[model samples]
Target: MERAKPSSIKRATALRYMGASGWQPDDATTALLDRAEEKILAAATPRAAVRRLPRAVFPPPELDCGTDLTRHLQGCDAVLLMAATLGSQVDSLLRRLELTDIAMAAAADALSSVLLEQICDELEAEWRAKFAAEHLYLTGRYAPGYGDCPLELNDELCLAVDTVRGCGLAITPQHLLAPRKSTTAILGIADHPVTGTLAGCTTCHLRETCSFRKQGTTCFAK
Candidate 1:
């Protein structure tokens, strides 16, 4: 019996999903994808949670990121701190695929990448609708590890949102997110219309070596 619904897949535009997943399937490879997808879906346990906090109180003006955070949260009254994951089962499945079947592992990995983003998207969409009812709008989400935001901030975010307690998400000392298929981000809420525009490849610190961007793909695209 299923305990939880599987995370939904977000298809990419113009074959970008294929690039994000790192595979262009041929007829031979196509036969195995259906099964691979099933494996991923069956193993995934999608979970997410959001916490609303005044931008100033949450970040503390004395904190180093406060300046940047203020800039990021400009024109907003609060920040929606979010965390989400596809659970540990997907991690085990990926490990098994790595040892027993490299091809399937690659495909599963790509799908997981898309799935996690899709989960975040769904959560954001719900928040958008909720806030829109009040005539407020959400700004584009900004995550740690993007642009000047340090991955180290993952710790603060986890603590602030109690991600481990609320959504079963954790971060290692090195700042690697646990479940290996999870994300945390900040969304701004304001009275005026706020278009959530991501920094995109141009401003990304890793733009040069980004495999997706190199292949003409971007994770920021809707």
Candidate 2:
């Protein structure tokens, strides 16, 4: 029943979600963001769970999660499969907005996107602290759809974490994650923290043309 209680989501983060390259928010955008924040606060039900998976299960059958993952998980004691969600109500709210108001719908979608990342941020912080207590450290979170990690691996992640039962999240046959704002990712655990810079946006498939990248911003920046 643990949950992520995000406090004061930054306007800049939401603006970025709306594809805003600059800091200024026009009146209309500001108003939409104001309204969207209310929806996010009401709808968010952040929840997360992490489970240990033996390294032997690294490459699930038919999964082509790229070589980046192979390097990330190298010299690990075990792999951790993580799943987190802002819950189904958030999706329901976004869907309802699509029919009622297109602008609001888009704004709501953006807000939810930022909120989900905030939730993941909280989850990672908690995990980091927990592992530190045991003299262990975690590699940066590497999710399916990152680098060589195929989106299809979502199925394996969901199954490994029992995501549906644990948090009402799932992956579709098309590889999209459900509870639309939810996420599944992996982390490598070791006695020592990762020594060098971990590959993040530099290894992303969309690095070349990502809008945020063009603005010198990366979603993966810590």
Q: Write the per-residue lDDT of candidate 2 for residues 159-219, one digit (tens) a residue.
A: 8888888888888988889888898878888888673235677678788888778777787
**Candidate that would win on TM-score:** 2
**Could you report the Cα RMSD, in angstroms, for every candidate shown?**
3.3, 2.5
The reply for model 2, stretches above 4 Å from the true place, is 26-28, 59-62, 195-209, 213-222
Q: CA shift at 2, candidate 2, in angstroms?
A: 3.9
Candidate 2, TM-score vs. the true structure?
Answer: 0.87
Per-residue CA lDDT of model 1 for 1-222, tens digit only, reads: 112454445433323555635446567666666667788888898888789998667655554652444566778888899898989999999999999999888778878877777778778888899999989888877888886667878888889888888888999989879989888889888999876555656556698888777766676654
TM-score for each predicted model, relative to the true structure: 0.86, 0.87
Q: Evaluate model 2: give its lDDT.
A: 0.79
Off by over 4 Å in 1: 1-8, 11-24, 66-71
